[model samples]
Target: MSDKKLLLLSSSREGQTDYLEHALPLIDGFLDKSIKNVLFIPYAGFAMGYDKYEDKVNQPFQTIGKKVTSIHRFDDPVKAVEEADAIAIGGGNTFHLLKELYDNELIDAIRKRVDQGMPYMGWSAGSNVAGLTICTTNDMPIVEPRSFNALALVNFQINPHYTDYQPPNHNGETRAERIFEYVRANPHRYVVGTREGTALQLKDNKLTLVGNKPGLVFRDGEKTRPIQCNTDISWLL
Candidate 1:
């Protein structure tokens, strides 16, 4: 129950960046000796498309030195998460991910598995599930989420790819700023910005960084600041 490892990749892991290419390889590293079976939980991309987010989520295991058996579930969901050595969730829409997790009764299964030391990896919307509340997610709720309580596996809310780059047609503040604003008002929460090509690695109760970039932690109304990464995580060490 204590050897679990989690690699929560920010949204852009599917993006075409040079260092982002290391995404899958880093995932493979988690599966090297500890992981034997893999469960591909494509709940986030539920209604979107079976494209990059979902395929990329599973493709890493199919090609690597490790031969992982994948299970994609829209049904018989409970059995899927319960039978795996590891669980990988892909990115797309955060609401959709929450819906599927609730509808399929996979939330309890996932939380239980993760608590039991199953290696769990998620990207983007998938990664959003790392925090206690799904409110920090930047994705517009195309559909109402089934639940607002995230897995609460970590102590902070994760705003993956926290960019100040605001695109036009957006209503108010940019997604990043909106998240910051929301958390600012709600001072009880802690949020971390997992930038592109970077990941928050939680293993054996240790949280560390992987890929090329480091994550930024934001609190209060202050701007996000980068912390030194790539070292033993004092948090769980």
Candidate 2:
């Protein structure tokens, strides 16, 4: 895992901020200066055409002196991944994203690259694929993938855009309850519930939570706990 570098964000925007604005600084810090071009995976943005998605992302990336070329633009996506200096995945529907990845046979190609020291960044559904499996994702199964398994860049599961708030007079499971259910079913695994603005950073064998709010962790037979920002959580890795 020493060669792995991952920045998994809970969401693209945080409370009225511009798209990716809150994450720009963290992205800059995570990426190496040598990385000028980033390969983007826009499969999750199925509602918005890939061309539009790429344009939306490039706007922010250009500000940091980096450029993103969407994988959809390439004839051979696996080859694109192999040749990419870095990779960034955008958020939308996790199921759609996974299905597209499997259809294009890019899961293994991307995993191999990231395992060999390529930088990876993702947000929301994008972040969901970085976990052990997509079972913990908040997204609806609008489409089915060949498998629930994901990148496994980290050892645990991720629940992005996590919130415990129960709206007035609404009868439904809270976010914590859903995560609790997942832990009960998968007793051995850990689930990290990242708030809207938070992110999990893994580099140099160290894992840290970034942002002002604390993240939540849930596991079977263990008390749920808060993960403070800017603290070491490599143990979870």
Which prediction has the highest TM-score against the true structure?
2
- What TM-score would every model get versus the actual structure? 0.84, 0.98
lDDT of 2 by residue, 1-237 (tens): 367999999999999999999999999999998899999999999999999999999999999999999999999999999999999999999999999999999999999999999999999999999999999998889999999999899999999999988999999888888888999999999999999988999888889999999998899999999999999999998
Off by over 4 Å in 2: none
Error of 2 at 142 (Å): 0.7
Tell me model 1's lDDT, rounded to 2 decimals: 0.71
lDDT of 2 at 2: 68
Which tens-of-lDDT digit does each residue in 98-209 have in candidate 1? 8767776778888888888888888788789877878888888887767798887777788887666766786777666776687778886778787777788887566887
Error of 2 at 203 (Å): 1.0
Q: Candidates' lDDT values, in order?
A: 0.71, 0.95
